[model samples]
Target: MAQNLVLIAGATGQIGASVARHVMDRSGWDLVGLSRRVQQHVPCPMLAVDLLDAEDCRRKLGGMQGVTHVVYAARYDHAGGELESVDINLQMLSNLLTAVKDRPDLRHIHVVHGTKYYGHNAGPGPVPYRENAPRSPRPVFYYAQQDFLIQQQGGQAWDWSISRPHTFCDLVLDEPRSITLLVAIYASMLKELGLPLRFPGTQLAFKSRTQFTWLPMLARSIEWMITDRTCANQAFNVVNGDAERWSALWPAIADYFDMACGDPEPERLARFPESHSDIWCDMVSLHGLRPSELSTVAQWAYGDYVFSPEWDVVSSMDKAREHGLTESIDTRQMWRDSFDFYRSHKIIP
Candidate 1:
């Protein structure tokens, strides 16, 4: 119905690449993907440009020049080794916004943010965060990118929206991209060794009440925001709409992997209560290389988070529903899809 030209930054990232692919599927929309390198297997039109450079990014991001919309997924992905990731994100954000300033055809902007903006870095509060909640005072540098958007949109000249999705998992290809999926893979390894598939060693804060969002759903939602004016100037929470206990979710995962969860005796568990480890401890144990081979049964257990006894806050998308967004993905189905995808790609070794 409409001619659209779209630009996406961070096109090679786990989320960004998926978003790019989805947008490319649009009939009347032209998608330009910006990345540092032209990786093999990319289907969309890509421009090799450094987003950190304001001038180059402006020249390269075609959508800014009478182009339809811009989606900023760019971030420092050096495995979190760059301690100044927040600062880097904020600067790139400021540059990108300035580069596209005052473009006539720019209709909307959709930025992907996680629940980390809800002060997950601080701690979960009972606030049940709404889209309009006050920016966190202890804002991480990443939040600044969002604040910049709010400031730009406050002028009311362009269509703008933000999506705060919760606990999304990807193809389990890396450490930082999909942490929950990383945990799932670890749990799979545990089941291989006849270990308990349930939360081991510690009780988590959220007690494993978590929801997952699928890749296709997240990507398409961004596309929806771009084409629909009704989505303007609002914030939305993306949830998988399914919640499950941390303990019970393990069996579902076991079924997906076709692996058996070893039954731990209740009395024996009571005696060796310290057998399972928190997320961090389990990682250190596994990577510590205590055993040369996988011959010994590693008594340690792996779970959702390194820190336990904290509440895993559930995000609600009720407000988004009020604004004409009704679609969502199922958690269990989404996780199984990701598992199958990773196995198919041989991504998890």
Candidate 2:
């Protein structure tokens, strides 16, 4: 049997880090982590290759040996409240594939995609988004990447799979894009201010049903996709298999922080943190918490986008289940577990 070596792109990110950890803990595989930043803490060889530069990707990745799998989780940098660049995003993936696709040992490629493929970011997508749903007319980078993968893999021995997870719920301390960490930070700030934990978005978002993709579950699902031949060239929506509204979850969250839950009051979270830096610094000192700047701890605009959605955001898990990945998690428990993790890590007091 050939030794399985998997190259994980974006290894410092929430998804890539979790997946790399999963691969590391498992037997019968070796891993290499690629990222633009140097992550000395990751438990594998690291490649500091810029995915945006085709030559850089080639220079660093072109000489790889026995790379049996590729997990493309890297994303191009872009601000919230705008469409991510299709050309640049597509180029990143193209650069990676161009560097590694010639390896005869490569058996599979798995791309970590998201619900945005359904245009949920722009507005409400179809209720309970399915893998078979038509391509969103909106020009999203996800479509460009997927199309490139489909075209590039034609008649090739290496098969491909895509996992579409909704808002990722990650517990990694270093991940700044995490919704779980963002909310924890937000609630802690409100608690320090002696204000009730007010729902920061509109009433529509408070009432709209939403879902989350537990990072660990998504990692396992990606492993299943790569190993299971049946998953070849298919897309699966990987979610917690439960839908929830902020109205129901907000109170529980407030209780965890020992604060009262206030009714929905719309506020632009993107601007909320600008005025709360001193409060966070004070909390860090008083609680002996981990030193993290407020701005770097969370991307407030992402929270604004998440909390302002007026439509239900759900994706069917039946496809993954029918295909033999039967894992499911309780959405409420996921939230509680996330809070517990942040507290354990001293990310919140």
Clashing pairs in 1: 201-276, 205-309, 205-310, 205-311, 206-312
Clash number for candidate 2: 0
Candidate 1's TM-score reads 0.77
Question: Each model's TM-score, in the order given?
Answer: 0.77, 0.95
- Per-residue lDDT of 297 in model 2: 82
Global lDDT of each candidate: 0.63, 0.89
Taking the tens digit of each residue's C-alpha lDDT, what string does model 2 give over 1-349?
A: 3278999998988789889989988989899899998878776778899998999989888998889999999988877877789999899999999999988888999999899888887787678898989888888888988889999999899999999998888767677787888889998888888899999988898998889899999999999999999999999999989888889889988888889999999998888768888888999999999998898888888888888788888889888999999999898888888899989989898
Itemize residue pairs with steric clashes in candidate 2. Answer: none
